[model samples]
Target: MDIILTSLINLIVFVLGAAIGSFLNVVIYRIPAGLSLLYPPSRCPHCLTRLSPFENFPVFGWLWLRGRCKHCQAPISIRYPLVEAATGLLFLVVLWNTANPVEMIGYWALLSWLVALAFIDLDTLTLPNSLTQSGLVVGLGFQIARGWDNGLNPATVSHALMGGIIGAVLGLWLLDIIAFVGSIALGQTAMGAGDSKLAALMGAWLGWKYLLLAGFIACFLGAFVGGGAIALGWLQRRQPMPFGPFLALAAGLTALWGETILNAYFNLFFPTW
Candidate 1:
């Protein structure tokens, strides 16, 4: 009985995520283009033809449309369906890992923000301030509110939350400066403000303790990929690569499994502490 109920809940969450993913497509396109997210409904980029209701179905719509604009037959980017599916999977994962309603919502918001930043950075090499800055302020606010809602002591919760905010901001700022100095020292732009914002959001949401884990994982993956690309001739030496995706991946993993990983590490190495 419990299994069935859980499966049903996960399915519902996936569907909701798919729906939100559809909207995120609009955000990914319009936000970077400086277009209004509202007004002027989704239309074909090539023909400017407004899509019909049936043709607008999330992932299935792209499949049914045969990856082409219905009016002009211009090929649709495969990324549309990919984004929808990815968001659905993220929602499923978050739901599976989180039991608290408040935490679930917060995790979803973080996931959505990361998805936008990842794609935007991939395409344009930029992460807009709107999502990152808003995420920092809003996410920390929720942490405090969650503490209050749980009937925690005001003074303790306030101090803890304030410390988390300060620690996270400082950690990310330090990372930004290190990356900046490294770029200057190497005579190549190795990282940018977008990556810094990504780290900031991760630190804010996951707290200072988990920030190190996220940063380490991101750096490891980034380095491995950078080396591979350099070896394969896919990238030139000193060429820039988007780091937001690695950081985002690390953030999602940390959000879901930070405690487990941290506990395992401590049990193995720092048992006495």
Candidate 2:
């Protein structure tokens, strides 16, 4: 009975997350387009047909509609269902990682922001200052709550706070330097302001030490994927690729495995510390 109840709860969380993902899709697509997210309701971009309640059932709705607008027969972007599924999976992952309700809710909020940023950056290649600032505020609140709940030593909290600040400063400065150099070499902007804001946001959440890990992982992943695309002749040398998604991916991974990664590094270097 207990097992069944747990499974049911998980299912409910997944469904709720999917619903939130559906709404996030609105924010992601409409915000970049300069459209009001709430005013017109969800409509077919091709036909301007407003989506009915039955047509708006998150992942299932898209699948049931066969990926086309009901009225105009226009094909919908696969991102709708994909985003919903991704959010659902992330919800489960966060629950699994943090059993504490407070921590779970906090991380849920954090991941939602990350999801929104991921899509917005993919669409516009820009991260709105609004989202970044909001995330920073939320992250600080989470840190404080977690610190208080866990009875962390003052020194640990101090370290974490310092780490967060250093992460933001270093991430921004490093990206700026890279952008400056790239502009000189390529004679154009190679990085977007969104990527910088994203790095700072990640820093605020994960702190400086983990930010380094996340950035390194993102760069490595980007190189691997980009190189593969180049080798397949799918992308040319000068093709612009958005880096925010990769950073988000790295941040997500780090959020899950950061402590283990950090501990391993410490074991390798300090051994007794």
Candidate 3:
């Protein structure tokens, strides 16, 4: 019975996450387009027909409508349903990992913000300073609050804060150097401001050690995936590709497995910390 109840709760959380994902889709699409996310409501991009409540039911609606606008039968972007499903899966993972309601909420909030950042960067190739800056502020405040609640020493708190700042600055500066060198070598911009902002945000959340780990993981994943695509003849040589999604993925993985990874590395190398 307890197991069944837990499963049921997770199912509900998934559903709720999908609902929030639907709204996030609006934000992702509209914000970059310089349109109000809430003013005119969701409409068919082709025909501009307003979507009714039933017509906006996340993945189900897209499936039922056959991936077309209800009024004009125009094809809709597949991103909508994909985002909703992805968000639902992310929420399910968070729910599985956390039993504390407050902690769950914090994780959910972080996940939502990350999702928004990921899509926005994918579309615009620029992370809005607004979102990244706000995330840094909020994440630090939350960390401080957690530290205080746990009765951590002020020295520890100070160390974490300094580490976060140093990590963020280092990540951003390293990316800047890479972009400069890549531009000189390739004659085009290799990384965008968005990528730098994202690295900074990750540093703010995970501190210097995890930031380094995330960067290494992102680079490895991007190289593997990009190489696979090239070998498959899907991406041409010298063709530009978005790197934000891969970075976001790396950050997400780090969030879940950073402690384990750090512990393993320390055990193997230093063993005394």
RMSD of each: 1.8, 2.7, 2.7
lDDT of 3 by residue, 105-127 (tens): 76676678789888887787767
- Candidate 3 regions exceeding 4 Å error are 99-103, 152-160, 185-187, 264-273
TM accuracy, model 1: 0.93
Question: lDDT tens string, model 2, 1-273?
Answer: 999999998999899889989999998987777878788988898999999987998899999999999999999999999999889989999988887887788778878989999888877778888888788777766766666667668866666566677777777777777778878998878888778878888887787778889988888898899889999999897888778889888888888788888899899999999
Instruction: Flag clash pairs in model 2.
Output: none
- Which 10-residue window in model 2 sums to the lowest lDDT? 155-164
Global CA lDDT computed for model 3:
0.81
The whole-model lDDT of each prediction reads 0.84, 0.84, 0.81
User: Which candidate number has the best TM-score?
Assistant: 1
Stretches > 4 Å off in candidate 2 = 152-163, 185-187, 264-273
For 15-55, candidate 1 gives per-residue lDDT tens digits of: 88887888889888888899999869888988989888778
Work out the TM-score per prediction. Answer: 0.93, 0.87, 0.86
